[model samples]
Target: MDRAGERSPWPWSTVRRVLATGGVMIAIAGKLLAHDPSATITWNREVSRIVYERCASCHHPGGTSFSLMTYQDAQPRAAAIKASVLSRRMPPWGAVKGFGDFRDDKSLTQEQISLVTAWVEGGAPRGNNPNALPPAPKFGEPRREEIPTSGLAVSGDLTIDRPITVDGLWPEHVPPGASMQIVAAWQNGRVEPLLWLYEYNDSYRHPFRFRRAIEIPAGTTIRGVPRDAKIVLMTADDNSWFSRLRALFRKTG
Candidate 1:
């Protein structure tokens, strides 16, 4: 047996540091923020609400790597957010927008972009809603139909009931220091090898394993790891289809 043990890839400890603690997440968010006042819109409760409706489905917690659920999540990446939206990176979402009609679209309008910009410049204030916004959407089990049977499928005879969506065909912005962990295993004698990597909306990051593969047995209990855990684990690259798509359209648009 492979010992059925757990290991952390990174040389760090497990601690839930706040976002402002000057960690990798904060560092990246700070670098991506912009200083231009003219391009920003004054965001109040209303504006933030709109952003939540249009953007946060995927940007929010558990849907993907980062959570745009709170002001903290969006504030740090304000500049990057503007860049992606202005360039239609946040919403247009296809290798070329207007090429295909998608069920879920996260692209914002010019007005929406302006609104987000102003919100950031206005200090990204959070207006009062006695009840905080609902929790970010949660990911469910991978669905058999959702996985591409043409290219790859889960190993063995096993299948996922909930969908592990893979949005793609274009590029979009992902929050800095966002993290994700996928727990999967080989099935049916590992015929397909059960390769899993990150992709941006552009469907890039193919064969996305930057490091070596994290091999597992046919059935694995430790399918994934968390960012704050002892392991650094794995992350999808900038061009990953899932990363970009999730950032823009909420789901694999």
Candidate 2:
């Protein structure tokens, strides 16, 4: 060895170890810096406009059932919101991929879904920028008033037999499979209207069981309806004629 001389070329193994350690450190740092784009956008601009435009019609205060107005209003229920959005459940309007044109569609855009997911993950921080507040949504121009329509009869009472979430399918995304069945008895108290609600977000003709009407109630035409007086029958997820005609009417409008 030379006097006061230092050493040899670095071995391959040592070089690899050093490189691996550096790579890991770099990865950790990148993760720290890798914030969700939605959060950044929202902090810059009140991105809740996506909600107002795409969702708040039904999911706003004094609306149907839920609200997506503000971060504070949404943060507590962030996880559920995430699940619903990712699954495309909250935007209850159902238009399957490649389906016909829908006039009043409310499915989320890819960017919107990403924004909501990112916001939820980023602690749902409502940025201090005073401008970060979208204008109050106006669900305008109500549809023309139609004649009083009779709701579908629930031949029998049925519950949400299977408990899981569903998704909404779009041009860029396909929802996961979710199957639920509703068992019902006909108004005649004999036939049953078995409704199978699948969440595949695809198109396929499926068969349902409902025997033709035999008799009508006094002063009442035979119609499928919920046995429970409290249950309010409404349209299914999608606005298909099949969904409208073969109704799985329930209070879970």
Candidate 3:
């Protein structure tokens, strides 16, 4: 309304325009807050360690992929890294977490993924102190002699013929981008989860070592594996002296 107004020019259309403008300003303010530089998440403080420990194995100098060893190297690719982790595509562990515990699990925890998201959303700040950064990860040439040549491959459901101590599983022949869930169903009706392959890629295939050895008794049926998908049961010799000693202790005690 103007001071000399006979009839006010204010109308529903003008009101809507003003409201929309206000909304835009509010949205901009929210974005500013979300991208606040002072936010706790920073490359040096949190993300560096995570990347060094988890991603640097492949994303290091002279490694298979591009290096993210320094803040400068990682900052520009922050959004890409965030997207990869959010999609569960980086750290390339393949197995779904919590289904089976593994010693060499490389998948990020939900909290860790959230930290990365917040860091990226907060403008990927490098912390104040450069000295606070963890040491860059080191890599060694993969020893050819250490790689396993063979393992017991099970294609479909298989019943254990004898008690065997299993250390891990290897996805031997799962088609790229295919998924499979393997489980060991005991005769007494206890089902133990073995491994879950989600959108698996053979390029990153490796043995999924269990956190602890699983002693599967005879008659325990390995099930849920697809007919075309072959999973290798990584096992220790049941006749080994260590295994015999453990079995003797189990029987005596």
Candidate 4:
């Protein structure tokens, strides 16, 4: 130890001893942490909020999915809930972990997902305060539907003199026989997949909305190919029909 309380470089001969000490400390700390464990997770205080905000939108009546609004509704499905949320099949946001920052991101962090998993494995307790639970989530009403896109469009691919950005596309219309394919995303000259194929499935047919706007640098390029496809780009808030005829026949304000 020096006067500044910093250690000078250890002699090479003592390096092995120092490393061995660190290893032992790390192992002991790991065991201590394991013994302590995380706090017990429960539904009424924790898990319900996660589900109501993410799952109940689709899991409620008149909304095309089963209800998960109440403890009773969800208790029976605890295992499946844990499985789906952990696998990211629920909430349905498809951003690859650590890939991009997004607004309105439905996907939970790993810790949040783990809490749900632990709650289930720990017997899905309702906790001791059911009456104090937050009001049931009201996501099933008529409103803008949730969109599950592959991920945010990224643009660090370009070597630009200035920053660039792209306001996201909210696809409002698709002409029949039209299909769109996102082949790949480019970043710093490296190719990555942000691919999606337009299909007959309802989920695929629905328009995609980025959870937030995307910024495209001046030199970046996102290459996509369309085949016999007619997709009309519109804002997320646009409620207008795609057909020219529909616009023509609509009553004026």
Best by lDDT: 3
Off by over 4 Å in 2: 1-46, 139-253
**lDDT tens per residue, model 3, 1-253:** 5578565677878889999999999999999987565667989888999998888988888887999999889999999999999999998889888888899788898978988998999899999988878887667994332333444567677777668788888776887888888998888999999998888786558888899999999777888777788787777653443334333222110
Kindly give the stretch of ten consecutive residues in candidate 3 with the minimal lDDT sum: 244-253
Q: Supply the TM-score for candidate 4.
A: 0.53
Candidate 1 regions exceeding 4 Å error are 1-44, 95-101, 128-201, 204-253
Ranking by TM-score: 3, 4, 2, 1
Local distance difference test, per candidate? 0.42, 0.48, 0.81, 0.56
Ranking by lDDT: 3, 4, 2, 1
TM-scores of the models, in the given order? 0.36, 0.42, 0.75, 0.53
Residues 207-245 of candidate 1 have per-residue lDDT tens digits of 222223333332332233232222111222334433332
After superposing candidate 4 on the true structure, give the runs of residues whose Cα lies further than 4 Å from its correct spot.
1-37, 144-165, 169-212, 215-219, 223-253
Q: Judge candidate 4 against the unseen true structure and give its global Cα lDDT, from 0 to 1.
A: 0.56
lDDT of 4 by residue, 71-162 (tens): 88888999998898876766665444444333566668787798889999999888896775878866535677545232222212212222
Could you report the Cα RMSD, in angstroms, for every candidate shown? 22.8, 14.7, 11.6, 11.2
lDDT measured at residue 105 in model 2 versus the true structure, 0 to 100: 49
